[model samples]
Target: ILNFKNLEYFNMDFCTAFSNSFLQMSELMASLKYLSLSNSYLNGTILDQGLCELVYLQEVNIDRNNLSGSLPWCLANLTYLRLLDVSFNQLTENISSSPLMNLTYIEELWLSNNHFQISISLEPFFNHSKLKFFDGDIYAEIETSHSSLTPKFQLTSISLFGHGDSGIFPKFLYHQHDLEYVDLSHLNLTREFPNWLLEKNKKLKRLSLVNISLFGPFPLPIHCHKNLRVLDVSNNKLQGHIPIEIGEVLPNLVVLNVATNAFNGSIPSSFGNTWPWGCFYLEYLVLSNNSLQGQLFSKEFNLTKLKRLNLDGNHFIGDIPKTLSNCSALQGLYISDNNISGNIPTRLGNLSFLDAIMMPNNRLEGPIPSAFCQLRHLEILDLSRNNISGSLPSCSSPFNIRRVHLSKNMLQGPLLGDLSYNRLNSNIPDWMNRLPQLRYLILANNGLEGEMPLQLCWLNKLQLVDLSHNNLSGQIPHCLYNISFNYREDNHDLFDQDPQILYQLPQLQILYTNYHNHKYLTNFTTKQRLYTYEVQPLHSMSGLDLSCNKLIGEIPLQIGELSRIHTLNLSHNNLTGESPVTFSHMKQVESLDLSYNNLNGKIPPRLIELNALAVFSVAFNNLSGKTPDRVAQFGTFEEDSYEGNPFLCGQPLLKSCNENGP
Candidate 1:
């Protein structure tokens, strides 16, 4: 293609096989104005003298590659270049002395996620009057410079993420009046909220000053910036009541996240008010982890376009506003860790787009409304730590439901189940067979009784099963081996890796990308201690705990088929017979406990093959003869692992194998 003398544009983005030789040939195309090799796996130092020969080059993009070493100094020769993107690479160079200082005509520069250290002040680009878009990082401390050195350019979008202390705001931004997007997150700027930025930039649309240590009450902009859409001041020390007219001031906001701040007082009623043009355009509103008090909303509350409302970790009182149902487009409602009281409104079922309803650790009461069954898109429903009573509605089933946490409630009777820490008194219900997508079955700490049901075996995707501390009895269900305890590792499409469960709005895409890091969590007893597992660990974990139960009978040999299980606990039961020799096939078993049982006969010497075993115990069993050979993980076991097995002799135990005549 380089042979074509007049080739003005050449694009090979996403062409991973493209070689560095292409860069060497680019100098031949003297008329080339635009060249893009993004994500083309181009590595090594960029050819210093190759592309610089194309004096007519106006744009260059080499982003998302493995290109290392300092940027070519010859880039300064391309005076006509207007846009240059070398982001997401291994480029390491100081921004002050870099060739970018000579790109006086450059309008757009993208240098994010690189090892480029920036100077305390942005004096290098002061002469680049045409620069409008600059997105880079500050990897070193930025000293507060009192010198009144202003730049000639007014950037429309500037994003500078600081890794070290940026003692104050970038003084250059003070003179920028045409600013549209500004993100100076993680800077640790110890100054008060810079309200002057808003007062100056009338065209600003998105401003994210997250974790910058900005204190003092957030002063609202005096003038209504109609173009403003997103305002994220979260993870700061901003205190005092949030300006009540905030909604009226920024009516077109698509996202307003003020979470993890010291803000107090009630939410501005104007947030839910309709403007003369139409309903409020606000879609994602987050006010969690603040000292905010008072009722959630007033009588006129109606934000029709609101999608995700998070009012959790606050002192907010009063019932959840019934008018919340008016948000027909709502998807997630998080009001957990609050003082809110009253029954969940059945009207919430009207939100057809609702997917998550997390209201744990609140003063909610009354039975869960049966109308919730109407929500077909619902994925998460957490109402734990409430006074909700009565039998669970039989029709409580959403086709896409993935997590249900109704624990610590006054609920009774058979459950359609994941209801742990409740007062339910019944046999493991057969209705559970209908939940073919069940991944976690946590019915622990309840009055559940009866034999381990055969229907549980139908849940082929089961990963964790905790029936410990219950009245459950009868032989361990041999059919449980039919369930694939290891589901997540093999099924990539079962659950999305992205924890952001809510739908992404196009407008707030960049501003609200990291709004929440949601993770699936559950508590289970393992290694004689209760532990909470979440996210990646939870997905890779597979365990079964039937300890502290009335279960009696020979250990099911079929259970040895669960070779991928991480934990297996049948301790504190009346189990009999020799430990299964087939357990040697448990290649991934981390914790295995068969203690406090009537199991007899020689210990399975083949069990020594479990290299991943971390917590192993056959203590208090009536087993006799020498223990498994002390090697691999078995060598790490102490005397406690074989304490109560009086007839069992091993290296770890006080008794010798010779004394037991092994």
Candidate 2:
């Protein structure tokens, strides 16, 4: 809102609020020359009343907003106005016959993303000597029709986000040898990635052809750009191995992200060596979620400056590279959900500022190197579902840790030291309490113990806490009511008949309790008393799972308070509860797993309103009723996602229900 006395250029670009405040600039606007209000929330039709009052006005822009109405004659007076942009508005006007053609000095014209229908004859304004840049849906010839009429040397940039502008890929884009950047992202442009892109190979530095339906096993048959620095071809249906000679084609390709595609092939072995001796000094590598299967030959890339390397969700296996320590500047390493094995190298902790280590669901064993504490800046350490053994050390990480997933690991026993941050000098760092930054705590199936420390609740940043199947036995701390539990919940009595049972840590959105026994290989059959309880506002914990345990008594109707639940797993428990009408609150549940438990009741047909419910299972239960027609995925589920239920009836099961009435 700074006032200018001699403003040369005034552009209120994309500022909706400022556009509404322009009424106050009427006097100031009259004294000005160039004015631009591109993409503002300006309304009303163009009025020609005080038309040529501002004779000095040179350029005016009011593009992309709700402004609608006919062209005003006042626009013709500003003869000096060159760049006239009124694109993306609800403007209704003819292109050739409009008074805007009077601006003989007009340099650039833009009327794209608006409701302006292009008439066939739009070649009149094409002769404007200075009009080199124009954006509109009209495909009119934009050059003087002469034997050798040349376009001015002022054509460099263009933006086309969608249709109703420039009519699909411009058929006229052929022999313009000069270029720098071209962005055609998300336009439903149904054509092969224009072959001209690679062929046009002038001095273009950036090209984004993201999700333009450029289908193929390999879109580009040729890769011969020497200076292309950024190439993003993600989310397309492209398949096949990335041509190994890609480096030879584009020697300077630095950012190559072809993720989320359906490519099928082993990553080339001579990958890094093929790069023209650090030709594509790749700083970011993401080739995840494809059918790619191969040893992520990470040892190949010794690029000292590489920071992010993601090869996850593929079929990769093998020991993580020991030579990775050479990439000393690495900041993020993600190779999760792969078939990787072997112990992580001890030097991995040397990645001083490594923020995330996503290597879960792998066959890695051996205790996590205590030296991992050396990664003082690690925010996420996801080593879950690994065969890692031994107790965890009370982390003395200097930085605040956000996520820790040691779930399903063979790690056992109490933490190495006093485990309490209060005992910092004596081994445990008191900073742990001061560091209120534990977002996810999934230590399930680990042999961790020592009455759930009250100090843990100090992790005010807790979002997901899964301490299930552990030897933890203590009252659930009352202070953790604000922490969201994702996978499992700390049980009542913490598993003992202790009266000081920690009833609830209310912020839980996804609760998975070890319903019965603590020790592994033991069948839990507890005779706990059923008490009517009204859970507090536990609406945040959406997924509740109390399966794989033993607890005698019915489920509390208060369970209905979890309105946000998307997955409710109550199978394999000894609980006997009729389907309470209160279950209607679980509207968002996608997977309701109530099998293997001794629950008897008719299925709720109204439960079909849970439109998102994709997997419904009561197979091993004593329930009876005709399966609802909406039980689609449930019928498709293997007897496992729905096994154990005896009274349940569905197509996939042996028992068939007779009626839809519950």
Candidate 3:
């Protein structure tokens, strides 16, 4: 309160109610040395009459407020000021020429995200011998011509954060040998890789030069023993081979990302050969989108503490070294789009913490080892487009599997009847009915033969059921209408359940790669095109593909209760039915395909309500009717969508809606 005349520290941040009244008291706080009104939503100008008289104030933080108008030039009179943070405010107009330059003791200056006029020179502030941290847009070009005007301060950190024109790399950086953190990413600095910048900074920890115009090969330092933790130079024009001694030299590295570069040559064998088992501090190593070749070293990796390893988008050959199993903490392994051959090491199954293992588009062969059953936390297991054969491994339980991409291989065996693609060849497993999390059950293109098991209806959360291209028979289960996830209820007891229960589901992530510049992942066919879901939206994806099977019976009316289903394909099957009128309830349905089937009925008029329908095909069916009015998505359909039905007439077709031709 203003009553405290000697109060040296005043902080009103997030005090939404303390508005104009607080700004009025600024004139009384002449002795206040530190003041922070950040995010207080305070309005009004900080004019010459305000706290500008507090010339002895050491720090001021009024960031993220509604404050407007030019900060009074008299702020420069605060000769002892050490910190000034006015970022994210409406402070327009430039500060007086010497406002900040005159503060001989100002140490940290933050003027980012403000509307200040771009006519100020940063050169003046550099003269302060105590200034250490400066974050602001340098509008004027930093004059590198002044070799005599050396910076008086030793800056350990500098961040322009890609604001304003990126002037040439700060020349003064050469003199400040204590630099530890630097971020010049997404800037227009057209300089060659600055190898000399690391010469004196023995404690350099983090460095990011991403998306900059730095060119030429990265120079290998004479000695790389600094305690650097992160080095990201991704999306640059850098090239040449990574140094063979890099692993041994940068022993404290935690992240090494050089993706999307033109780097060539083999991954150095020294990476794993020199370090003793579990001696490295690295956790994430990404080298994707390069041309690195040669067999991954068999004895070079002792990565017991490693977590994420991405070597995809390369030409690496030979077996995935069995030594990879030595990384007991490995979670994500992406080796897709490579020439890696031979069996997946059974020892890899020992990594029970693995969450994703995507190795598609490779030359790997042999059956997936049963040892993988131990990876209870695995969510994505993709081995598609490989020479792999034999039935799928009988994982004792697929409790956490979300997406399994094993198509286009030499594999044989019955498709697992549930979301799991196990080696089960019997009636639909009873365990599948008990699974409350079952969503996608893709067993198409296999030797599965049996009745459509009624137990499947118990999967209240089922979304996608792809039993197509198989020998399935019997009637559709009517109980499918009772699916729990499809119905949103208002009676849910929010107070009775712990919110943490929702976190039990494994986190979804993309287990993918780009081959020939196209994303290659587990795909689902719908609307005449193959689709892949991104990780987040994948949670709401719903579809069914029971086409190309020998299924028999009437289409179940209960199917309409699945209001959340998006794509339903029952085409190319032996089903007879009056197009279920209940289908109109499938308001979210995007594609409906009932073609090449035995069905006779008037196309349900209510089906026209499916506004989200993007693809609809009912051709080759024994149906008779004036096709649903040419409206909404129906207007986009072509005659071929209804061609086989000689009795069906519509605008898309030349046939008229009459007794003889319609």
Candidate 4:
């Protein structure tokens, strides 16, 4: 309760803990230059006498809290005050004239997020230059919103909403060449940005038209704005290739995020420029969800200062360039869903400080180089759906790994000796014994063999384990089924393409227990031999691959024991019999491709309950008896997904009613 008699600035809006207890500082307001008791439980009337007492107050902010009463009506007593923010309160005050009209020096006034029933009109404060940051949808700027025809202030950044301020988009927003940061994010604006944004690009630094109904390939001309930096047009209806000459567009740009857009073509090679000399000098770049093609990262450029680069869901091709090792400051690198080929560059292991590397769904090959084991600080490493081969490297130190995905590769060998679908070809991976903190582990689609190690069950930190689609044939481990981790959408297709029915995955997704790899089932029961497909991965690990091998047997009920398997691909096996009921425990599966198998039985509705089913496929199997109609995604079978299954019925195929009854 100190009397801040000489206080210059005081804002108590977000501090919903105290109250007019600050009124004890009246002795301080006498000489105060700025005072704001917003939402600080400030209640009752705002008397003219109480406010007029502060003759020297310069700024006031009282927003977002319960404050009642009308606005004070009096002659301009505090002529020195410049700002007044009284928003989000219960004030039925009319802001037309009174003392408000006299304060010509008042630069910024914010009156929103409140229950002011009175229709507000901004005719009081006009021609205020510093009054740029206006936040209200009550007919703010005349250009963006179709609300007000006339504006009161020369605002550079106005976020005015409609009705209760469902803030409308400013049509002429781009014309304001002086605007630096314009954020109308998530205000439910339905209008598209005007086309003139590119033409009038002036000194604007950050331009964000995200979540707006914008279309067309962004045609931003680089020479338009010399000072422009951040250009975020994410979550829009945009399409087409990122101009290959993007570096030529906004040369001084730093952050260029066009994520979730429909953009296509290769990442502009010109973007590889470095600092002090070449390229866009970018620090952060996210071009995910575009249809981009060709080597996403090349030896052409060296983004030494690049920290985060996300290019997921693009069609980019070729090997990750070794020159990219020059990005000494790189922290997060995501290049998944591309056609990139060749062995993962060992040079990347030199990035001792690198944290995340997500490059799934590519054509990358070669063994995971042991060099990556040096990244003691690594957090997330996902290399799913690639042509990668080779065993996991010996992890040298305590890895800070939280998520490790090596699924859907040609990798072969045992995974800590545990087998989800088939048996391992080598001994239990030695490096796995050292990982005490491993949370997620996926080793599907390999030629791995051997008995699962019991020590792996002791990993209290282990969450997900996917060792499907290999020569791994044996009893599933128990610790995985009972142990828990936050498994959501990864367990649905836990063991797809195999010749068996999937009965359960109590907590996770066993999406496609009968993964149908019919083409490779010629030698199903006899050939314990492993397929010779070559593979490698981004992480130097003791990988396991038995994919495309015609291994067959009864759908082991013990398969349910691998509780944490992530990617289980037992497709193409001539395995038979109903899926074991115990498999309902694998709560953390990510990819399960059990297609082209000899499995036969009704699709287990219990398996249909897997909430984390990402890639589920039980095509070309003998699965029968009206497939479960409970899950929507489950009913989404294509002609190919259930083609060879004569007994299967329901939507996604043609559902047949009981022939004997209605």
Candidate 5:
């Protein structure tokens, strides 16, 4: 209100909107030093006429708004401005000649995620002696002026992401000694590693130079800086062995990611050793997609604080070290695509906090350790593409389990399994009735032969059922529609006390900041094409694939009750009777395949109402009648969709319905 002439701070952040009189009222509060309207739905070229007139303003934050146009030249009147955050807006301007050049007293500036054309050269801000933080755009480019000017300010944090090849690193960084955080990721530097940056900034806490086209060996700082906590140099061309004395150099590191590089040689043993006075605090160690070889771990290794360890896509060999069991805080373990051979270390069960175990495409053998049942918090278990054999052990504790991938193995026996692409020749496990929380049952490409068990209907939570490419046969269960393939109910409350839930624990968040980015993928054939579905998409997907099986019976009309189902494939079966007219209720059906069957009678013309249908095929059947009307999605259907059914005639077919006497 204009009556509050002494108002020093006015914050409307997160508000729906500001009244028309609010701006006029704000202008009267000449003593206002702080004004924050971030995410307040303010539009147009910002309130430059009113806010910029407040010459005594010290801080202005209008981020996350739809404000557009160039930075107002009137902003130069606020000579005492100490902070300016215009990030996440549609504003466009050139930083070289903007009003920002006059705000010499500015201490912090945020211009990220905008259309600001920023020059890679830092000479524009050389006069801001008090500038402590500078965040710029990802589209910054090198300036034509190749001046080697030194800045007067000593920034504690500076981030400038560039597009394409930006020539070389900014020479002005050479004069900075007070920097604590620096990120030049995705800049396409195409230059050698800047080891000198580390040598100069002794107090640096976090350094990220990812995907910057950095080449040559990664040399460490000669002097140890205990303050440094995170170092990410992933997705580069850096080669050579990691420094052996890294543990002594940066002893307090919480994250060390060097994945997707050309680095060769075994992991340095120094990583296992503790500091002279205290233990190493390392938590995340990622070295995937490299040429590193040799045994994974040494006997004397002792990294008790370790959580997630990724060594995938490498040449590493030897048994998984039993010493890994000592990492009681461990959660995720990824060692796939390697030459590692031997039984899975049973001692891994000692890690009670473990959640995900990815070890596919390896030479592992033997049955899954029964000790794994101790992991009550486990969510994902993937051991596909191995020599694992014997029956699946049952101990029952991981009630939170969601996904299981044990395909491509020699495992055999009647047990609760995801034993697809294996040598399992027994009947589909009836014991599956006991697991009430089961969601995905993938047993395709196996020798399992038997009648469809009625017990499957009891698993109401089931979302995806894949039994294709097997010897299974029986009548289609009418009760199959009882399964609610709807979106999974939120079960996060079950793991409320678990530290593996990143958001619940602040300490674990620091260690698993990238944990949510990890995807849980599975292969499913749909519309004659195999698709790999990731976690988010797979959650919304509901399909039943029983093609390439020996199933026989009439198509169940009750299946149409599954209105949310996205895919339904029952082709290559001995099904009889007319196509279910109730199929028109499947509003979400994308791929419907009942081809290669002995069905007869008129094709349900009501099926044309399925607007969401992208793939439709009833070909190679003994049906007769005109095809569904050539309209909507059916208009895109070709002759192959109606071929092999000689009596069937429509626009897509060469034979006319009049001539065929449909």
Candidate 6:
């Protein structure tokens, strides 16, 4: 293709093989009017000279490449250039003072996500009268002040996130009337809600004001424009109740998120109200971390196309509505930490598209829904801290269940039986080994009996295993260290979302809850204290907790091999043995509790170098020794952390080390 001098259009986007050889092509394809090499694996500094020779080029997109260095000063020579997109590259240093200003024909310019160190003025950009899309920073200077400025272009889209100081809204926006899309996110703009921008740019289709300092009640206009598709005001300082006419006014809205705000009061029943057209086309509605209370069973919320509805961290009270089954297209429903009561609706299983059902920390009760087993695509099921009774649902079908949390619940008996939910009092079920995709399984504080199942060793993807406070009695399985996700370096495929579920949903967010990268939240019992971890922190965490159980045996030395393990608790058991010096091999362990055991040995001195150790306790043990040297995290421990062992002595403790004792 290099021989063809007539090549006018060259597109190699996402082509990893296309490298610096593209720079030489300019000699042959001088007539090239369009060139897009985005996401290509091109390395080294972007060529400063070659691109200018292609004077006929109208559009050039080389974004998301490894190209670095400052903006090419020669770019201004390409007066015929209509569009230029060099975003998401490693380009560093200051831009040329008058860069691309002479390109009067330029209509679109995207220079975001680069390390342009110097501040730029909007005066030069004013020369490009045809500008329709400008995303780079354009801080106003004395010459470009709004009162005297007269912009020649009418921008349809403007994105200025993390671009400039949080002064008043760019006053130049007052000159433009055709704006359709605007993103002022992550800017400390202390303006009052930017309702004036909404009033002026009525054609705005997408408005994002995330993490801004906007104050005062959200000014939701009574009459919403028909084209307003998305409105994200999350992570702001906004207060006051959400307008009651939100659903009725923003009828065409698709994504409405006001999460992490101070808004209080019950969610208006009008929130569930529909437009005159009968159905709502809304897809993602997130109102988490607000003070919104009251029942969720409003007649207005008949969103059939809804995918993700997150109403967590609120004070909402009332029964989990059975009418929620009407949301036939629902995928991820997170209503945890609310005062909602009532039994798990069996009808929820009918939504074959459902991926997660997180209803933890609620007042809901009754047996686990056996119909939930029918959801072949279910990835997460968290019903912990509730009064949910009965045993786990018995189903022989292969599943995609990765995380199941029934801890702190009233669930009783062994998880064994067929689909009929009949009692089969026995040991841990052998069928648990069949679910190879299982990563986190927590059933702590339940009354499960029988020896720790050896079949659980077959879970190759197991990362977090907790069976604490149970009636189980047996030596811990030694093969537990072989779970692939923890032991293997190439277990990336294990934690990934099921390929079948991904193929079925196709969209990046199946139900608008982006949990593909997020692991299920799990509580860790380290140092005799419970700590809750959400998704982000769970990715790097691996743990094993079998404390407060009746198991009687020596601690498995093989547990030391789990180098990726972050928390390991085996306290309150009747184990008898010397602490494995091999335990020092756990380099990444953050919290380790081996207290309340009949073990007899000196605390491993090698453990002192465990730099990541934040919590370490071995109280109530038969151990006797001078505590490990108090350095780093060791200096922060209290005397109670090493109490109940009268023989052990240290600096923080009242008892001192014996003279000349090793």
- Tell me the number of clashing residue pairs for each predicted model: 0, 13, 2, 114, 0, 3
Which segments of candidate 5 are over 4 A away from where they belong? 1-3, 17-21, 138-140, 277-279, 414-418, 424-440, 447-463, 471-474, 477-521, 529-542, 550-553, 561-566, 587-590, 596-598, 608-622, 626-662
lDDT by residue for model 6 (22-71), tens: 66668788788998998887777666437777888999998878787776
* lDDT value, candidate 4, whole model: 0.58
Against the hidden true structure, what lDDT does model 6 obtain?
A: 0.73
RMSD of every prediction:
3.5, 13.2, 6.6, 12.9, 4.5, 5.6
What lDDT does each candidate get? 0.82, 0.57, 0.72, 0.58, 0.82, 0.73
* Tens-digit lDDT track of model 1 for 1-662: 74688899889899965467666676568789999988888888876427677889999998888988998888889899999999889999888888999999899999988999875467788899999999888886676566777898989988888898888787788788999988888889988988889899999988888888999998887877688877888889999998888877888888888989999989887787778332289888888889999999988887888888888889999898899989999989888889889998999989988888889889999988888878888878888788888877777444587778887888987774367788877799775777888888888888989998899999898899988888988999999898889887453431233211122336322223333434445688776788877646778789999998999988888989899899999999899888888899999998999888898998888888889989998889887898778899989999888878778886887777774284
Provide the TM-score for each candidate, comma-separated: 0.91, 0.61, 0.80, 0.60, 0.88, 0.83
Q: How high is the lDDT of residue 85 in model 5?
A: 93
Lowest lDDT 10-mer window, candidate 4?
Answer: 517-526
Query: Which residues of candidate 4, in runs, are more than 4 Å off?
Result: 9-17, 24-28, 36-55, 61-80, 84-105, 108-129, 136-175, 186-201, 221-224, 273-279, 297-299, 414-437, 441-662
lDDT of 3 by residue, 1-662 (tens): 66777888888788877666655566677678998887887777876236687766888988878778887777878887889998878777754353675776778877766765432234555577887776664444344455456778887666554544565776677777777776666565767777777666777777777767677787745676556877777767788887776776677777677777888898876567545322277777778888888987657577677787888888999998988988888888988889999998999999988988889889999988888888999877778778888776765668787567776787766544232233334455555665556556767666667787777787777666777777777877788676643432233332133222212323312212222322334456789676765423445667888888777789998887778788889999888978899899988888899999999878998777899999999999888878988887888889988888887876788877876655
Per-residue accuracy of model 2 over 1-662 as CA lDDT, tens digit each: 24665566677677776556454555555667877776667877656223255567777777656778767777788787877777767788666777866776787777776666453223454456565565555434222333343333333444444442232454334534455555555555556557576676457665666665666655443646776766766667777887666656666765566766777777754346645734446666667677788676655656555676777678887888787787687777877778989888899888886877778668898878877888877766667667887766556544556555555666654432111111111112234565565433333333444454557657654433334343444333345434333324354433253111222322211111222111111111111111111111222333333344343467666555455555566555566768666666776666676667677877666665666666666656676655555354344555554456555566555666665532
Positional deviation of residue 287's Cα in model 5 after best superposition, in angstroms = 0.8
The regions of model 6 sitting more than 4 angstroms off are 16-18, 43-49, 92-96, 117-123, 137-146, 196-202, 222-224, 268-274, 277-279, 415-426, 484-506, 510-521, 527-529, 553-557, 576-584, 589-662
**In angstroms, how far off is 204's CA in candidate 3?**
1.1
lDDT by residue for model 4 over 30-55, one digit each (tens)?
77777777547667666622666777
Q: Please report, as a residue range, the 10-residue window in candidate 1 with the lowest summed lDDT.
A: 494-503
Check candidate 5 and list the clashing pairs. Answer: none
Ranking by lDDT: 1, 5, 6, 3, 4, 2
Query: Model 6 — which ten-residue stretch has the worst lDDT?
Result: 416-425
Q: How close is candidate 3 to the true structure, as a TM-score?
A: 0.80
